[model samples]
Target: MTQQTLQRPSGWIERSRPAVQWTALIGLSLGFGAVLFWLGVPAAMLIGPLLAGIVISGNGGKLRLSRHAFVPVQGIIGCMIARMLPSSTGGELGIHWPVFAAGVLSVIVASGILGWVLVRMRVLPGTTALWGVSPGAATVMTLMAEAFGADAQLVAVMQYLRVLMVAAIASVLAKVVGANPHHAVAAVTWFPAIAWLPFAKTLALAVLGPLLGQRLRIPMGPMLVTLVAGVVLVHHGWLSIELPRWLPAIAYAFVGWRIGLRFTRPLLAHAARALPRIIACSLALIVVCGAIGAVLVAVAGVDPLTAYLATSPGGADSVAIIAASSNVDVRFVMAMQMARFLAVLAIGPATARFLARRATANANAAAAAAASSTDS
Candidate 1:
């Protein structure tokens, strides 16, 4: 009877372990997210939960966010992106295709050069550096990094770090140039009056899109499928994607935690040591992108503010917010941003692979020369 009592208690504790861990994970995510939001950090909702997951994982938390939850979250994020890019933006691009093409190419080439430099310097190991500085959507790049054999954790660090820095510089510059705060888009209410039919349609897309994408075996299939379909549907006025604030918050938190929880102590330590170099690379990229923006101002005959926001090496969503709050041409800013995003998506993977191979070859030749010298 005594033995049975002890065993039963042990079993009970074992069963309760997951529940306890989950509770802690949720609590930490919310707390960190709130603080970051208060601090006006860009992507705070995503970064907060990521930081929380890092803390949990560092302290031996074993629980993870499931793939089932993650794929749909990607769909929601895809929808969020679609909402920002309007059909008018495409028309704007059509008007100034040459200028837009040149600007986008310049930014991408600059990013590639920086990425190659990182590989040559051995800042981050392998082709991870290439993926890190792809100049694409930060979240999408991070999500796709693992599939390409890059270290997703390190890529996340580089991508988000660059994002935070770029957003900060853009915001301060906007304020300095007298951007009108009143022009900012209205904040969405979390529990707004729901249009059930439209909301249901959105839910349906979010669920079915990913499933079909996975079945098709496309790279980052879920997100790509949802992004394409959402854009087409919304652009045509055939669908209205109604995502309340809380819905996206939940999605961001899930993606963040999924990445963050996989971090090990060694990985965290490595990231800490590489922090300074990472910061330098991020700043350098921003400066280079700023140079690109200046070129746009001179050649495209646009205002400095519009040029800067248009060529900013940050997330489109963050840049959009800054552009909207300013007196700049919002359509032009978004158009340029979208054009660059599409360009990156089309060419980023192949370029990253090519540059990575070159970096590796260069490293190998250098190592061989060093060995020959040592033998002599």
Candidate 2:
């Protein structure tokens, strides 16, 4: 037979590519998410997709969810937070400015202490330890760690581990404290009302939010942008809408997937070795935050559920999801999270650098002492 006649069809392979990718993405994310959701995992949509992303992407296949997809997802979440924040549905999240301020400061201080402890114990590199334990701004810390001489991958691993731990722990805690998120959404009948106009309006604003955020140089542009617009519109009484609950679930999944996809084989190995330390560090932060949360309970007059959600170490989107379902004050929780997030962004780098230097000096001194003893 002629060589050309015997050649396998490259066209078939090309045609199969997209189909294969879609099957993997849908099957893995949905399969995992559905099972976990049924099992009563908090933010199951996010967690399931996140875990699946790690498994699928980590293996050999690639899922083709576009980066641009995050914009609307974030926007949807933002609107939801704004819509539910001041609603009359949940418990009164007393806005105790003084206690809230104290809580924010406490979270930062506690995280810094843990970061130093990590450095001292050699749990992680200096910069990585510092930024990893910072209270908020995981994405920012991961992105900026390299500039401050931290291993970006290691920082990401640490940050994400804590995030995963916090989400898991906090979800359980929310239930124990009577902040049942499912019940929180039970009354919100605006969801599942899928229509074109409202969705389009939401999308337009969501799309515009990012464009404006890009122009304004806002960190975490899409979320903050749509978020600000939503809040502003709500107060002015110019905008009113509710998004399909499914969109936010997708957003959560995307967020988790984004973090999970970064876990490369070598990075996974490093993370595995450091898993115990990472878990310990994460638990330490939660303990400290929990203590501070107690103070918030007494001083703020806010329910335990709201206080805990506000002080939890995860990002705003995470807090909001739990808050929305648990009947915590979504607005108050967002405010606290955003404050901590911004605070970490501003001070985390400097603190990390200082701690990194201290770590190096300590290592050098220890090595010198060992050398002197050996020489003698």
Q: Return the clash pairs for model 1, or none.
A: none
Per-residue error at 94 for model 1, in Å?
A: 2.5
lDDT of 1 by residue, 1-376 (tens): 6877775232332345777878887899999878756544445666677778777776666677777778898788767666666766556678888998889999999999989888777877776777888786666767766876678878878887676566657766766674664423344245888888888889888888889988997656786688678878998888999887788888778766765776755556668877787787788888888898898888878898888888887766556545544577776776677778878878877787788678768877999999999999
Best model per lDDT:
1
Q: Pick the candidate with the highest TM-score.
A: 2
Task: Check candidate 2 and list the clashing pairs.
Answer: 179-326, 181-325, 181-326
Q: Evaluate model 2: give its TM-score.
A: 0.83
Deviating ranges (above 4 Å) for candidate 2:
1-21, 64-67, 87-95, 125-127, 147-150, 179-196
- State the lDDT at 247 in candidate 1: 89
Task: Give RMSD to native, each candidate.
Answer: 6.8, 5.9
- 210, model 1: CA deviation in Å? 3.2
